[model samples]
Target chain A: MASTTEILEKILTSPPSAPQGIAYNYLVPNIRGLETMVKTLQVKGAQASGYPTPAASPQSEQSPTSTSASNSSEISLFAAATETFSQKNTNCSIAESLERCKPIMELAKQNNIRVRGYVSVALGCPYEGPDVDPHKVAEITATLLEMGCDEVSVADTTGMGTAPRTQKLLQTLKEAGILEEDLALHFHDTYGMALVNTVVGLEHGVRIFDSSVGGLGGCPYSNVATEDLIHLLHSLGCETGVDMVKMAEIGDWITKELNRPDDSRAGKATLARIKG
Target chain B: MASTTEILEKILTSPPSAPQGIAYNYLVPNIRGLETMVKTLQVKGAQASGYPTPAASPQSEQSPTSTSASNSSEISLFAAATETFSQKNTNCSIAESLERCKPIMELAKQNNIRVRGYVSVALGCPYEGPDVDPHKVAEITATLLEMGCDEVSVADTTGMGTAPRTQKLLQTLKEAGILEEDLALHFHDTYGMALVNTVVGLEHGVRIFDSSVGGLGGCPYSNVATEDLIHLLHSLGCETGVDMVKMAEIGDWITKELNRPDDSRAGKATLARIKG
Candidate 1:
């Protein structure tokens, strides 16, 4: 199997000729993962003696000189919404987790990488009741933004979200002076409220959303299932620039690859209809 | 195991005194289920001999004098949005399913019972691609209404819905002269779009919604999961009149009785927090 770095490099270096823009995003779970990705890029540069005949046609090709213009870098860091969940999920207190991300965020900035902050259990924490203090969520969000983070994504990791809770969270954020543009909503469909939460977010002027393809990802602690994020986006009027058919195909492919059942309800229904 | 009719009667009688000003609607899946319910009610009446001290001053005592006067008899009939799904789910074609429902609706009306209609697979058919024609859905709605359905519920059975698709579907209904008030939106949390679809429905002026407690009922064919409807309603600032604590307790009880894992994300999280 290819190492994580090798995989990232392969995806990154594989001629940017595909019609799809940015087909892959790698998650760096720790500092080591980030180091691996950066090292892979360096090794690729050293190995490539000369530009091998632009892998494919460059439609809007600028000069070959711009090839070295540093690629935009982005990384994500996460904190839980409640102290109990924060401790359980990240093995650190909420404040401690935030403290841990300080160096990570600073390092990313030094390397010219934009850091996206994530606050998990925003709507309801698995270890805490649904009565998560909106003030606490807001305070944590402000701390992240002040810590030089580009944007923050609020995550309902347990999918225990409802429209009222989502609305209140957004209201709290607004009161905290966090503009809609500075936020993204990440929802788990464990209880089927993810899409509804998305709509509420949109009504509040939020545009960016974070979703997994085929509703992948499970609550490591709670063992809840979630719907695919892409499906939710497609249902909304906003254009995600992702091809639904292609996404369904990739969802099927990955499920088979992982030896897991295809988790996307939309993808399965679509494929069934087509096959029938 | 108790027969479906027996189970329904138990539900009706155990509650004893119906709540004042609240209407209790029961579901009879087929002709037999309906007949059994009627028989049970008649038997209970005969056994009553006379009104011997009404059980605990019936919840809705001011509404009417007799059970028949106060009780609004209504049952639900369901069909799928797609022909293939209709056939597989109900063992009949769309036309045949509608034909079958005609008698049921007529019978209910004759007995002064209202009939509520449901069209499953509304957003995306499990056996049909996302290209479900809105015209077809409209035609079905018209047919059900013509057959004397007091209200129609459009269900996203597979949970393959988004804001755009829901908006488009609602527009079609509006154009077809189906007032938003005459329609209810039923969505599954299969892909976490149920709540989002609900928001879209609300934007379209829909007030009625169909949701299962604890998000019970998985798609037999699609195997997709849905969110607890009551939870979604509570989250959206809508008054479902359901006790969240009671509902959560019921969710836990049902999950245990069914020998199925608790499928509710909210229920589980709430339970965890309370236990902690």
Candidate 2:
């Protein structure tokens, strides 16, 4: 298996071309991960200046249409709302996890990189069941924002979230003075409540959402589908500027490459509708 | 294959025992279908009096505790908003289909049977695409009510419904002088919008919903899962008086027996959570 550094090298080396306004985000676990990313960028920058390198790598700053991975201006860091989940996932308590992210957040800031914090199991936890405390999630989100995260993504990691709980969680966050613009939602589709929960978030004025192409990373159940989310948003008259048909094609291709079942209902239906 | 009358005879002869306050409903297509059901009930009623043949079939009126199929005091009739869909589904145009239902509606009333009218493709039509007219749906619903349907079920048969369209449709019905209590909503999970659309219906004060066990009858995409709907309702603090656990088990059994994949995410998750 490739080391994290090697994987970052591969992605930073051959990032796909995205249109203007699109961003490529990577998750950095700790200070070490942040250092590795910075080191990779430095080496690429040196190569681009023609110092013992074969050719210049496509740099985002050089050309807005550069094919090279948009310099990964944004990195993500994750923490958990509950103690047990934090310990099990990161081998540390919630406070320790936050502490570990502090240096990364500071370094990213110094390097002019934006940091996105993730509050995992914000809606529900596997070890704790479906009653995760919204106050705890709000507190963690506030801490991340204080630590210089541009925004915090609240996740229903176990897909145990329901519509009412989603409303209550967002209400709690609002009461805690968290702006909806500074927050995003990441929901799994384990119980198939992701879309409904997303609707609740929209009702609370949340605009940003995280979804997986073809619902990748979904195990036991599935993750929320990118195609489905885009389709829904467009149907609601919310202009996402994302082509749902193109997303469906990408979802289909990725799931096929991974030899996994395509869990995107909208993806399959879109293709069928087009073909038919 | 059994004829429709034979099928009704089998159901009326040996029905599953249901608890009190539970109702059993069947779909009767036309006047002949209604007459067949009435005849079946007559035969079952005669047998219950013990003039000759066998032991009395358990009757709901005989004893609330009796372990027999509840007499189907209600039946459903389906129509379509779009002319093409109506012609394709029922071999008649919308007006003629409603005309055919007139005798069924009259006969059901004479037999003291409640009728549920279903407006299929109310939210959208396969031939008409996603721009189904809410006014047309409201008009059909009003006509059904005028024809003595106790309740009208508005269906997004093609699963082309979205949140904004759902809200608009409900609002149109409300403006058409339709009472929420006299309306029900039926959504398919084809695009994974069933639950979200259901939330919109609830927001519009609609309480009745139609779903299938294990998401049966789902083709191309899938039907809304009964287990998922119940789970959502219960999570929202709505007392449906339906046991989700039992529903999950039934969904599992029926899907396995049918040799089809279980399309109910909540059914699978609920059973797994219980087992784990």
Candidate 3:
């Protein structure tokens, strides 16, 4: 975690013609963490182009990691929509957490590295339950955007967000004039509503989504269920250049690696098609 | 499986007025099965009112189980939208199977017993894949409805259906002049697309949905994920008289009984609301 050697290696090795909006984000808690990133890269003789950041100097006292990378990998800071989540997650109150991120955001801004913000449990909280008011989410969102964070991803940490609450939260943000394209929906399939929420998000004009490989983290509702999401998206005529067959193949391999049930329907169905 | 003793007992004990479309459907494979049903009911001395039929003579010789409950529980017959699925599932071609249902539908009509139809893999097939033509599903649906089946439930058995495919299928049905009210959507959360498909189905004016309790049966795409569908529906101002709290409690109990992880988001969240 300290070195981020693995992440940097992947970033350095990534194809040049990768699609737009590609980001590698790390959860950088404090300025010291940022300084360590730069210091470690320097000690390892990493290049700036390896990071893709142009003017990113991790700390005032140290130099940037590399001069070649035009855009530094993004750093993400967190807050919560509810009191208990903030306390449990960040060990602070909601308002206090945002204030803390203000400095981190400024640091990233100065280094020419864009920071991403996450509002966890934006739809519902484990300790406080659902009904974390949409206004509270909107307020936190506005603050994150105000703090010069590139964008805020509102996370339904509890997987408790359904179409109604997700829409309500989005509506609240939209009414406050938050651009829909500026938002990304992060969902969990704890109860299998992730894709349903995806439809709602799409209807509300949200284009960005956060997802993982293989519905990992044991939540099947993550970002539309991998290839199945892409399949659904493809069916809706959204051309994601992501090769679904390859994605499903990866999903199959990883689920086996983890010894978890392969929950990807499109993956399984496509596999079945191949056999037939 | 033959006797409906427990089922009848439950029905008899059910509240005086239950919600519309509460069905206790039995899969009647053929005439022998139909005869056995009536003969068993007759031997049990089941009243006509209890059976909910006025005249359903088993095969012409046996007398109708007394002038039953004026609307006996319905029977469901299965067909498939794809040839491979039809052959694999029911051991016949799609056309041949619909041919098979024709007599059964006539028999039910004569007996004053309604029959429901199920079109499996209506959205996508495991063997044939996602390209199971919408026209085939529409044609089968039309045949079933024309055969006097009371309603047809389009099933995404492989759970490969996402919003786009589901919408396309529903659009095909609509183009074929099928009434949305006469249709039910039975989905599997194979890729967690059930609720997303539900949104599309709702948009197309189809209301009835098929789901499992506790999102039981290990399918992640149950509509009961968070009571959110209802929440989603209610936000659109559609009143669903379902008691969500009771539903969640029952959901919790069932998941515990099955020793399966409790996967209902609304069930868990709503319970949290109560405890908090």
The CAPRI category of model 2 is: medium
lDDT head-to-head 2 vs 3, winner: 2
Tens-digit per-residue lDDT, B1-276, candidate 2: 898677666656655444432355778887878898888777877887442222334553454244333355589998898998988888999989988899999988988888999999888788888888899999989999999999999999989999889999999999999999999999998888899899889989999999999899954447899999998898788999889999999999999999988888899989998998
For each candidate, the alpha-carbon lDDT, in order, equals 0.71, 0.85, 0.72
What order do you get sorting by DockQ, best first? 2, 1, 3
TM-score winner between candidates 1 and 2: 2
State the lDDT of candidate 3 residue by residue for B1-276, as single tens digits.
536545544453341332233556778877666665555545444553343333334564344443323324668899988898789878988888988887777777766677899998887776787788998889999999988988999998877776767878898999999999999988776555666677788889998887766667632233334454554455455777878888888888888887986655556656765776
Q: Write the per-residue lDDT of candidate 3 for residues A1-276, one digit (tens) a residue.
A: 535655665554442432243556778877777665555445434553344433334463234443333333678888889998788877889888887787677767766676888888988777887788998899888889888978889998877776788888999999887898678788876545677677778889988777666667632234446766676677678878888888888888998988976656667666655665
lDDT of 3 at B178: 99
Candidate 2 local Cα displacement, residue A149, angstroms: 1.2
TM-scores, chain A, per candidate? 0.80, 0.89, 0.81
Model 1 scores a TM of 0.68
Instruction: Assess the local accuracy of residue B96 in candidate 3 as a C-alpha lDDT between 0 and 100.
Output: 88
Clashes of each: 14, 0, 27
Candidate 2: stretches off by over 4 Å: A17-22, A49-73, A219-221, B17-23, B50-69, B219-221
lDDT of 2 by residue, A1-276 (tens): 898778777656654444433355878987888898888877877765432212334553554234332344579999999999999889999999999998898889888888899999888888988899999999999999999999999999889998889999999999999999999999998888999888889989999998999888954447899988888888888999888889999998999988988888889888888988
- Which lDDT tens digits does candidate 1 get at residues B40-92? 76665675544332344456554334343233346889877799998777888
Interface residue Cα RMSD of candidate 3 after superposition: 3.7
The CAPRI quality class of candidate 3 comes to acceptable
